[model samples]
Target: MDAIFNYLDNMFAHLPKTEEVVRAKNELGQMMEDKYNQLRAEGCSDNEAVGQVISEFGNLSELAEELGISNQYQSASSEDKFVSVTAAEGEAFIEKTKKAANKIGTGIAAILLGVISIIFFSGYAEGTFSPTLGGGEPNKIYIAVGLGLLFILVAFAVYLFVMTGITTEKYEIFEKKMVKLDPHYKLIIQEAKENHRPVLTRKISIGVGLILLAVAALAVSGILSEDNEALLISLVCVLLATVGVSVWLFLSGGMIQSAYDKLLNEGDYTLERRKSESVVQRWASPYWSLVVVVYLAWSFITADWSKSWIIWPISGVSFGLISTIIHAATSSKQ
Candidate 1:
């Protein structure tokens, strides 16, 4: 009996909650219960009686029409319809956007701290700040190391906080099966896609432009005199611009991708797609953290600030190979 109700609950879980739907569910449940009791009284086994009741009651779509509640059911389906976005799903989307924005913002903040740390460390290493302040103080070296370590710790903490807050189960349905949307809802989805196409292109272009501008600013700063106040000022401006563009891209792209996901009922947000990613592919945060640590350690130990930039490109390619190998290994295991 409990199992029977559980099955019914699962069936109706996707539908919107409304007075009409609730009343219809109650009436149907009562009918099924009555029929089950009758079959049991006639000496049918528990399983047989429950099965008989379910078979006689039929599926919701048929029962809804029979009960003259088809219109209500259709309305609920239409109102709540999105390929992957239900009430809970909508909330999850919003939460995910917030998380991504926070991560981008925090990551940029951490990088800015790293830049400041580098300035301090470079000054200490080269005795650049000695004339202005005093003879090379040991505390300057300690401050440089301390700032570098603090940046790593703070960045890691932000990653942990954002990742832990995500509720993976909210997206589990996509792994289990595809959602079937009504024809009317499908048309709505199609319209949304078409309308957003131009906007998507524009947003992507703007995002890329901002990123390139930041890179150009950084490059120019690197070529300038180390003691030039303009170098520090330009770096600060680049950091602020990068952070602003990053946040905008995270939020805007997330919203657009959410609509696309809802339209197709598939994508990275779906469990099926997520499962296809290798464990190494999912360890992006940790991998990049390692890169950061190695970059900092190499620069500090060798005081090779000029050559340290090479580490980024090397690590980038290495990560791709590592992910490919892990993907192959996992695929073979499966």
Candidate 2:
């Protein structure tokens, strides 16, 4: 009986707080008690009855599934019969919800502040402010707005990092409990987590690339227009494209690649065969190598040595070098 109680406690430790899970555990306890009484009636020893009950209880996965905790967003309800268990679960549940809300609030505040700063500074810099408010060149106001936006973006990222830790801890606890319920699911989850990286990378890269192409097109078109308004629109379009590229690299592409590369140490497996990697897979090494050579050659030919500004060619050279390395390494490995 003590052994059974210990096992139950261990199982609950992995589960999130939910009414359905509590009810399931309570049901298991009752079933065990009934089984123990029946064994005693049949002249079985206390230890023997306890062992029988443990063996008969079966895997916890079905119970876990019934409780509807497959994802973080779902919650389960319990009746008055499990009030005590619900109280314990409630605290953890409340904590998770509060953390999520705080994260969202911080993100919203950052975005709103950034947009408002831009609008205010844009209007003021363009000399559109009313008599009471100070006015200046649009450029000066825009520069100030940019600084404020940058600060907000940095703060928002820090808040997100902290929130990530809390959610991940909750997920770890929930996963551990689920393992006792059904061991087979652990393998499924492990595989999914591993494969998610490549898929995420491919999808995000393709999406960002498309967006950049669109924004660049809009910028170029506007730049060619006769209207002065077109110049402002073109500048905005270029700014948007630059921001998109930075976000794609920082948030999506780099993170996904890091995860994929980490798993490379596990076995002889390479990330080349992942589902979203088909585009990269299809491109022959020779073709990519040629691309790198062409870009590198073009960058040097187009360099303007007179002006100290060297961002464009420098970026091009870096891309070419990295692409060349990936191509060469992958080719030899294949």
Candidate 3:
């Protein structure tokens, strides 16, 4: 066990300057040292004890591989823990964002189609088509083009969803391996539940990402045009995303930063500290609720009636509100 511990410590000492991998390796080395010390107290020889522990551990090569240490001696510690609590939450958020993008894309395509149809009808009712296509019926071509764009966007969304699933699997496997390496795994999980910082961070990232993403969608729908109704809707999304992020930071930053500061001071990871998720969620819920309401109201007012798309924003807001309420209620219980 001492030999194994020494080997691990030496391995970590030579690894590249990655804090996470180094930290995990140090933690593992410490555990090995303590275990070896205990066995020695029971009168085991250095060779016998080392042999026993090495056999028990199976292979250092496998341990290094599982921990993602490319060169058993290199540093890659940050990859051990989920980069942040928000990482998993980010996955779910990204999935929702992709769906929202698809819906927005589809809605814009349909509206464009309907408008072009109206244009063609109006032109036919009169004497000739518009000068844009040299007085020809460009309606069919426009419709086909709009449909093609919509399909392509839809396919892109499907691809994002698939990639999200794959990334999620990789994260889960990495998380499991981290737990295996850490004896205090359960405590860390409980701490995460109580902290809630990671989750909030994820929501914040998602909201921000969506807002930026909506810019492209807005350009597609002509919302970037001055005084367009779509402009107002796009503005609303931007505001919601911005407001949500601000609220998240307000709720989470101080607490998470304080905890992190303590970690930095300690210079080692410990799973003893705990906080309450309810505390953070309660502070954030009302603000999020307000943003949700504003968004829904905007969506309801701006959606096109000809397309019967009024329900989209309403449903989105309702769901967001319900989820927030549920999270608040559950966190309080915890």
Return the top candidate by TM-score: 1
| Clashing residue pairs, backbone N/CA/C < 3 A, model 1 | none
lDDT for each candidate structure: 0.60, 0.50, 0.46
lDDT digits (tens) for residues 72-109 of candidate 2 = 22332221111121323433543454455445545544
Number of clashing pairs per prediction, in order: 0, 4, 6
Candidate 3 accuracy as TM-score: 0.30
Q: Which ten residues in a row have the lowest lDDT in candidate 3?
A: 265-274
Residue-level lDDT of model 1, residues 197-300, one tens digit each, is: 78767777777677677777767776776566435544644554464565566556655566456435555434334344536545887889888889879877
* lDDT order of candidates, top first: 1, 2, 3
Which digits, one per residue and each the tens of the lDDT, describe model 3 over residues 238-317? 43444344444433443343333222222112221112323334555586567546643553465222222234355557
Rank order (by TM-score, best first): 1, 2, 3
C-alpha RMSD by candidate, in order: 14.4, 16.9, 15.9
TM-score of each: 0.50, 0.33, 0.30
- The candidate that wins on lDDT is 1
Question: 1 or 3: which has the higher TM-score?
Answer: 1
